[model samples]
Target: MTIFHKLVSRFLISPEKKNEIGFCTDLDDILRDDGKVTLKIDGNKITLDLSNLHERRYAACLSTSLRYPQYDIDNLLMAKFVRKGDRILDGGANIGLTALHFLHFGASFVECVEALPWLAERIREIDDIRISVTEAALSKRSDGFVDIAISKTHNQGSTYDSSVIAKFSHIFGDDIKFLTTPTITIDSLTSGPFDIWKLDVEGAEIDVVNGALQSLKDCPPRVIFTEFWDERVHKFASVVSASHPVAYRAGITKDNYQLELLDMKTFEKNSEVFFPISPTYVFLREDCKEI
Candidate 1:
């Protein structure tokens, strides 16, 4: 590290104390020698790993507002759908930030599924009794393992689909690494009842949905929050239509965090411009009230 960075890291006010001051020091500037930063959020001490440039960048963005990109949507879900002691399933839970938030929002139990072993270890470090950590990729296969293509430079965008890796090669760069991780379908991992599920499995959303079909039928969740890319929306819509009858595109910008009920026909009609505006989606059963 540069001398300036070292000085900043040593002298800057600690992130855990940021709330008292109404703002946070940029995490990249205040990264510690241990490669972690502890921030107090909503009365809980949350520590994040910034050992890599990718996470450092992500932390820098989150430090500004003390929240992640999906903060608003999660708040909306809690306010509208979640009840006290609701069970949560956090798919692609990177380091358990959202899981912590779910606990803060009154979740009785949370199951976190993360593909990367290192990231899963970070989540396990929290050691919260209400949270359980699983270190495996959620894929179509219930038992075998799956290959993940992880970017050496930026690990957050790693996925089992090589096509997704190639599509975003410029962002991930040429420094890619491959590894095989154990797989568990959502249907198998979640045997009991669950209320809310937040899924963000990169480009493998369809795989997760496919694996959870039986569970979706037997034990339907109150809400399902996920992201949809234009390329994969059709198949995802087709597959999820059986269980979730209501769909809405969640607007993520600062000024517009509202949920717009989507008309599939209209969305497809304007797919050229509409699909790219917001990838966030909320799916609910017919009996559930729209949020």
Candidate 2:
């Protein structure tokens, strides 16, 4: 075991340390190296093997697993909305975690859209079944280059990474060196119906949605999962609950694209913050009946 793992183990076994102390070490072992880790979620046993993958962002995976006990990437993949032989779209598919999750859940085909070449290359390394990795940003326009502020760290995909943002600006030096490859609208790239659609494009959720308006209207998926932060965007659809106090919406909408307000929950400051935003809502399509 690595020194980090040993340290974590020591913390975990310490009588004075809290129960949460050593948990991350165990998670590190599962993520950094190949091993079988069993997670008891919702009274059910789910086993994961990370033997073939590289060790990056293992902590985020572990944190996400602990935070959303019932809604891990695996659970989201196995969700009723996802099925075998179904086509799924993963926008801002950072490191292919969600894509891998969907693949594990049995998605026949997954189209992963990523803008950054560095992250896209990592996704390309994942050789799995029926997975297509696209290194392009999805926007409303047919084709054009956009400024994509890259993050040095794996988990920091947002444009707000303070250190990276400063470094990027300095490196580019008033020029467009930080600008990434060309971006394409979903309408221009996709040709057929899609089963599931997930968008986690930081703050550009609206632009991505606008780009795929045609597909959403024509071949509306059973579920549309997008991250929303600013309340202004909520006006476009209905304001579902936010994920955390400062996190975006995990809200669900109906088939007609109207926001569903039922079962809405408010956020409390003292409560555990899972997402970086508030009251993450899940939007379900109106036409989609619960499965």
Candidate 3:
């Protein structure tokens, strides 16, 4: 741990937690193929779960996700607009890494809601029938129940709302771990229509975009990869000024980890060039273009 302390903690970390997480797995093919770390996606495989650590970015974010697998470039630009059969809607499906990158970029379907019913049975132990995980959690009210506030040494997130996970004061309130669950509204957890909407849900992404405002006005997701925190940036500018269209605020390009979108007025007049703890946005709606 000392190539000069990993180049001074890689110049004091940033580049969106190093390559904007969500695409990694290789570090000598997962510690020389032993304590589990395999990954193939779309073509299957999966594995992972290197027996948890007290939490050091979950073991340096899975060995910096296999030693900087192109630093995840915002989930590789949301897996280049996932097309194959597309139907993603993985709002906070943590242990499922954006539903295994929209089922390895062919989507075909993916529900993975997740409120930690044991990480939705550990994402159905990765069996994948186009995934369905779903432990329940959506917002803008749906019936009731919604406590959440997990953090177990931070980075693994979850928030129902306590003013949106109370700015993570190291996982606030008795260092988080409450739970409760049961909240529906994304059109009552969908009965139809879906075409990409991988919201990370750290700060409730504005109560799941205010309970999916009538399912984004009757199914309107061509893209909506959520998250742009500055204490939720006014709940992502009040759900992108009421239901969508705020493309590009994406980040992670401190020097080569590609992707740097930014346009909403130069990303709200430069918030120190993003990477301020949750900067992933790719909204696109107004007569869309590029997923």
Candidate 4:
């Protein structure tokens, strides 16, 4: 965030309220020499270790500690669909926050795929069991490499996907450069049936799902949490068709606080209401009458 953004977040919003609403605090103010912070979530005081974390990752520790109930759509999806022994494929698992949450929810195993090496390192540092972190993007090419434009001061990261690169340029300036990262397909990553596939790959959401077709065919996930926008709407809609099942769009309120679930009809009609990185969705294969 910029200096102006930090100031506004500091004076206009109380630290307690900001934590409650999932608003990020200034990086320096939150971390001490020991690289840990004591935070209150749902009135429970907790101290999270961020010792080996990157500056950009402190937000993950904060959100994970609080579970961002009001802002993180994944938190809501897990509450509704995930259960003990369930296996979760957390594609684009930034900092592994949601992956940790899955384990906390009793998931027998959770595999997290992250493109950035440092973020992947943080995931492993956060836990040692019931979770595996891979520092590679899930793509069509098993041996391919993804070029990513990374934001050094913020959590923004993007791949060479047309829409993503465009937005990356717009946000980080035209001269921004990309670092090549290893890539692997989902089919090559997992061996057995998984219960849910959670993706937050910015604009590469469709590509990751497409590459996972073989895996989806062999052992379809009961639930899929996708982040979509106009650029990838067709691919998303194609996978979500008639008779698939009932669906709910999960998003935050205008202020980025308060989770909202919108039915398919409401979602399509209000497409313009969403902005990138602001919402994620949850879809299920179980029949409406069943779930």
Candidate 5:
């Protein structure tokens, strides 16, 4: 091949489709040798470590778009429920992106709960007074710790769920590492009056609810955005029924970014129809269901 053709083939385009990602020319400006990227979003700077193999996809997006990728449903939920001066608990925060989004959407304060120590430290390094980081896995217990399964490829896919671990083991085969992380109950974290909560603790949403029964009763949040699965749907809803009477499966419309709310009753009857899709849900207080 000629010199120009060789340069185009090697740097501009690749024959292998898998290698096409994370190959922007300006990548060196943001991505460092250690795989850290200092991304500027809407004038706020967030430095993230995207060294993990699975994290490169995010790095590629951050470098190109200058936005932290988030689920449209989450953006919709936050836009609708997160009122000004709202206090939010961002449980299972991965590098505090969603928490930053919460702040951007006008929340006065966001308490981020993360399982991995390193990830929590990254959030703290942001130095934003509106955001605080707590390093602990949410569980039914206030003391002791839990063993979480961390995947070598997908750091954000860490979980303490047995079913998830089994499935990941079968699929990835020895790429998962077990780490014992500190545990804390949702009730023990604060004294209440939080306006909103975003919980994405894999399949442990029920345990978090169980651990926060007291807080849920005394100082119930107006809205809760969480993840739920087919097997634990009913139990998960039942646990928080007293505080949050109405539940809806949240998602963006197939055509556009419109918000779609499916009633829990309807979702429960036909969950298989939405399987492998977004399992995120919104539980609302009776008075707040109109939103």
Candidate 6:
């Protein structure tokens, strides 16, 4: 670190010693206002900017030049389903990273559905012509208010913070606040024979899919990618079967999902760990054979 950078770090830490212990101060100037950071992914460069008041969880991962834990997995899934002029549905698009990837790769249009207003605001900052950003939660009901949970780490979006459950009386705790926003069922909100659908709504993956049953049945997108965790895997699997039984007819077993590992260059290789305990799952429609 340069002397000037070190001095700045020292100054920021001196004020709140306890809170600033592990915080990075070298980039504080660049982060002066919460915003986007331009990054290079698999040799392709893109910019990510978000609301200044909200902290971006993926910022650290992107800024440190660390590969996104699920980037490889997502890429593999995208490779199978994405084609030129294909439409993609990106649920829980936090900061538009995944949407950016699809748009950059040649998807005709991407509809990003984000529940958090702040995060959606950040996505709107992108002047890209190929992507459409929507600020609404996908729910079973077409119109109603739902609890938009929030976590300490990523104040903009809701997250499951099991560790802090005991300390805080509520799941969201005082640090987070809930706002009633417009909600829509996936089918009602979008009219699509969309080529690909990606869902990553924390633990609410099933609920979001449940609301999109009609669309899934009608279009049966070539591929579906969602973040499934150990705790909710069974529920997610059940929802997949019930909602799109024909599309997932091979059965809900682990093998049917076909998880492939990815490298920095976006190359695919087989691995045991397909989903990071807190990772993303990419599912290919049974009818669409992989090339």
Residue 131's lDDT within candidate 3 is 83
Best by lDDT: 5
Best by TM-score: 5
Rank ordering of all candidates by TM-score, starting from the highest: 5, 1, 4, 6, 2, 3
User: Each candidate's lDDT (Cα)?
Assistant: 0.70, 0.53, 0.63, 0.64, 0.73, 0.58
Candidate 6 lDDT tens digits, 1-291:
533333334444445454533333244454434445556544545554434332322444444432333344465456655788889888888877788778767798888888888878767766566778888887777777776656554443373334323333354656765566677778886546578888777666667777877777776677777654344655665566633332221111134335443321232132342333344454555555443
| Candidate 2: segments with Cα more than 4 A from true spot | 1-80, 152-155, 159-177, 238-279, 289-291
Specify the poorest-scoring 10-residue window by lDDT in model 3. Answer: 25-34
Rank candidates, lDDT, best first. Answer: 5, 1, 4, 3, 6, 2
- In Å, residue 28's CA in model 4 sits off its true spot by 12
Which whole-number lDDT from 0 to 100 does residue 242 have in model 3? 47
lDDT for 282 (candidate 3): 80
**Which of the two candidates, 2 or 6, achieves a greater lDDT against the reference?**
6
Candidate 4 displacement at residue 226 in angstroms: 1.5
How do the residues 133-176 of candidate 5 rate in per-residue lDDT, one tens digit apiece?
Answer: 88999899888888898766655768989877675565335756
RMSD of each: 5.8, 8.8, 18.0, 6.4, 6.7, 9.4
lDDT string, candidate 4, 209-252, tens digits = 67877776666777888766554655575664432355677765
Candidate 2, residue 196: how far the Cα is off, in Å: 1.1
The regions of model 4 sitting more than 4 angstroms off are 1-70, 168-170, 240-245, 252-260, 268-277, 288-291
**Model 2 lDDT, residue 180, Cα:** 53
Please provide the root mean square deviation of candidate 2 (C-alpha atoms, Å). 8.8
Pick by TM-score: 3 or 4, better one: 4
